[model samples]
Target chain A: MHLSFSSVIEILGIMAFTVSGAFSAMQKRLDVFGVLILGFVTAIGGGTLRDVLIGNTPVSWLRDVNTPLIILGTTIVTIAFKSSVKNLKVTLLVFDALGLGLFTIIGIQKGMAANFNPGICIALGTITGCFGGVLRDMLLNHIPVLFHKELYAVPCIAGGICYILLRAVVEPQIAEGASVVVISAFRILAVRYNWRLPRV
Target chain B: MHLSFSSVIEILGIMAFTVSGAFSAMQKRLDVFGVLILGFVTAIGGGTLRDVLIGNTPVSWLRDVNTPLIILGTTIVTIAFKSSVKNLKVTLLVFDALGLGLFTIIGIQKGMAANFNPGICIALGTITGCFGGVLRDMLLNHIPVLFHKELYAVPCIAGGICYILLRAVVEPQIAEGASVVVISAFRILAVRYNWRLPRV
Candidate 1:
């Protein structure tokens, strides 16, 4: 299959999400079906939510068969390499950060296409970047880390603002790439520095 | 305002959902904002999901300004009457059951209008009837009762099937009303009998 640059980024983002989801489910001792289901949910949950909110129906995942196949494949690969993978938590974090960046940009672009205001677009970006993990946590019967945890959504929000600002000074493609990098880097740095939001 | 029969049913269903949601949040000792948010979510979440799945854009709640107002009014009344309300558990269950039945019919009809298969229609009906509670439970950091608790979704499924069968032999209006009654009665009876699905 001839993969375009955009398609490659999409696949990588999906794979990252699937890996994080599979690892989380495995940590929770879910069964094989549970692991696969969680992986699929994490991979597509945010985008489906974004599409639904923006009134884009037959959600992107439903229309594209390859997305599920990729999730299945990623889950299997993660499982097969489980024993060989070291620093499992670190691996999950890295992939999650990458997916967060990619998905946030995708959501922002979709919001812009729908002619939403900048604030709404930023909200959509944060939701798209963060809600997959939120859904996964909710399914696991825990308060979403997004509600009370590290600097997660702040980076997405900041990146969204940066993207909007950058649009005036840079090419659209350059702004998109810069925003993704900014989000991913911010998240990784936050984790590295053990940064967290103050409790109320 | 002259209320049509369908509008009355819709209002009743939304009110039931809002009351149950408000009660659940209050039980958890949520603040005013949380209670109001949950009430609104419970009233609209199911229909929003149904519309999004069927590619219905600009979800029902977005188009209708009164729904939010109704939810807010219901939440206030529930909170104000909290002390006077006896048998809170029973009241919640009754309202939830009633909401389930009414929403199930609304969903099944929507799917039918979309020309979905009976199986898909039934799925949609069950989702509409059950997912509000699911979202509420998830937000409260608990496993959704729909997955492992009492006979919650079964009645919705059974009612959907009943509606489909009834449509073949009865008037459309009769089918809708009968299905709603069947679902509500089945759910109430199940609770009364403490009927539960056996663990695998």
Candidate 2:
């Protein structure tokens, strides 16, 4: 199958998110089935939610068999390498940030394609970037970290605004790449500095 | 606005689920905004999921503004009557059972309209019947009661199978109504007798 540049980025995001989810479930001491479910949900949950909310049906993951296969493969590999990979928290954070950035842009593009307003598009992008982790946390019976901590969704929202602005002056492809970089960089920096939102 | 007989049952289901959600959130001491969100999710979450899964765009709730308004109204009334309603656990369970039955039938009908096979339709019906409560429990940081205690989804699945069988011998309308009654009665009886599934 021929792979477009965007499809390649989406695949990378899926793999990264699956790894993040597998590690998280393992950390929680979930069984093999639980780990697999978490991996699949973390890889596709955000995109599924976005499609569902926007009336895009059969959802992206269900339409393409490759997505599930990729997640399954990732989960198995992660499990096999679990002991060696247990010490790489920083690496996990990096993968999570990359997935967050790529998914945010993908969500924005889908929203724009559907002619949603700019504000709504940004919200969709944020939801796409963050909801997978949200679902993972929820399933583990924890209040989602998104609701309380870190600079999680803010970068996606900011990057979405940046993408909209960049579209007026640059090529769409360039804007998309730039937005991904912006979000990923911001997320990494936020983690490095222990940035957090204050309580209401 | 004229209500068909089916629509009337649908409205009752919506109201029952909303009240169930509102009470659950209130018991947890969530703020008013949280209460409203829980109520809304409980009322429409299952149907929204079913619509999205079947490629039905602009989901039923979004197409009808009255649904959200009704949930909002129900939440407010529930909060206002909280003192008097606190002792009505049995009433709440009855409402929940009614909602489970009605939603199961509605989901089965939609799946049949889409020409899905019997098993997939039965699965869809169970999702519609139980996912709202599942979501509510998840958001509250609880392992979904559906996953553990009570004969929750069994009644929906059994009722769905019965609906399919009844279609062979009974009028379609009668089959629909009969399925709802079967599910509700089964659920109420299960709770009264403290029926439960064995641990895996």
Candidate 3:
């Protein structure tokens, strides 16, 4: 089967999230199995959640063999490069932003395909973009960064609304591409400016 | 619709879990909305997880109006009796155990209805029983009690297996009722005796 543009972005997002999870596990001194588990969960967690909420079962990962293989490959690469990977912080953040943007659009599209309300679609998009990190942070026993960190979910929701608005006039691919760019740029700028949500 | 025996237990479980979530939020000094959100998540989190994993969608709460109402009522009661609720530690634990036992069976049955493998069924049962509290603890920024506490998942899994075994020889209702008794007893005893799994 020919891989679509979104499919490539999805794989890239999975790899980025996997690296983030693996790094988190290493920082916490988790065992090898824990590292792999964390990596897998982080990469697919948000999508699994979105699928489940929408009643899609066995999840997307179980359906596609390639996703797991990619996660495994990413995990091995992360472990192999553990010493040098620390120096690639900027690259990692960029990949993470890419993953967030791509996953957000994917989630919104899935929700839209299911004919959910726009509000539910936006919520699904935010959950898709942000919950993987939230789950990763939670498993590591810390507060989820999405709850109070630099604007993450906000960008996802904004981008999702933009996608919905743009889809009416633009081709689906164009709307998706625009949303991805908007989300990634918003996240990158927010982090650069050290923006944070007000703590309750 | 007429409520089944398991349905009553399920509602009770939802209320108990909601109370636990509300208390955790109060301890964290979260505002009213936070408290309500935590309560709702804790009460529905596990089953929502199980359903999603097995392809059940919109989740049980969204299907049944009663579950959300129970959670809402429980949250209000928890807030109203905050001063007195703290003193009811034993009561809370008992209710939590009741919820755990009931939710486990409900989860198992749902998995069985979906025709999952026995191993997956048991896992679904345990997740259903335990994940709400895990989510609750995570939201409160604590390590999941299921991972390190006094034998939580063990009982759920063991009870789930028993449920499967008993179903072969007894009526389904009998098997479910037996499993609930076994799980709740095991949890109560473990807590009373301070039983814990060995750390890896």
Which rank order by TM-score, best down to worst?
3, 2, 1
DockQ of each: 0.19, 0.18, 0.23
Task: Compute the lDDT for candidate 1.
Answer: 0.81
Residues A1-200, candidate 1, lDDT per residue (tens digit)? Answer: 89966567778778888877777777776655557656876788888788877777767664555787788888888777876553566766676777788789889988999899999999999889888888877776767788888688999999999999998899999998899889989999999998888899
Give model 1's DockQ, 2 decimals.
0.19
Considering just the first chain, candidate 2 attains a TM-score of 0.94
Q: What is the DockQ of the complex in model 2?
A: 0.18
lDDT against the true structure, each candidate: 0.81, 0.84, 0.83
Clashing pairs in 2: none
Q: Positional deviation of A191 in candidate 3, in angstroms?
A: 1.4
Runs off by more than 4 Å, candidate 2: A1-48, A57-133, A139-141, A145-200
Off by over 4 Å in 3: A1-3, B1-23, B26-40, B46-55, B60-134, B141-200
Better of 2 and 3 by lDDT: 2
Name the candidate that leads on lDDT.
2
lDDT, candidate 2, A1-200, per-residue tens = 99987677777778888988888899899999999999999889988888888878768777789999999998998899887666776776777787799899988888789776776677679879888887988877776666556578779988999999999999999999899989999999999998775431
lDDT value, residue B165 of candidate 1: 99
By lDDT, the better pick of 1 and 3 is 3
Of 2 and 3, the candidate ahead on TM-score is 3
All candidates: interface RMSD = 5.3, 5.2, 4.3
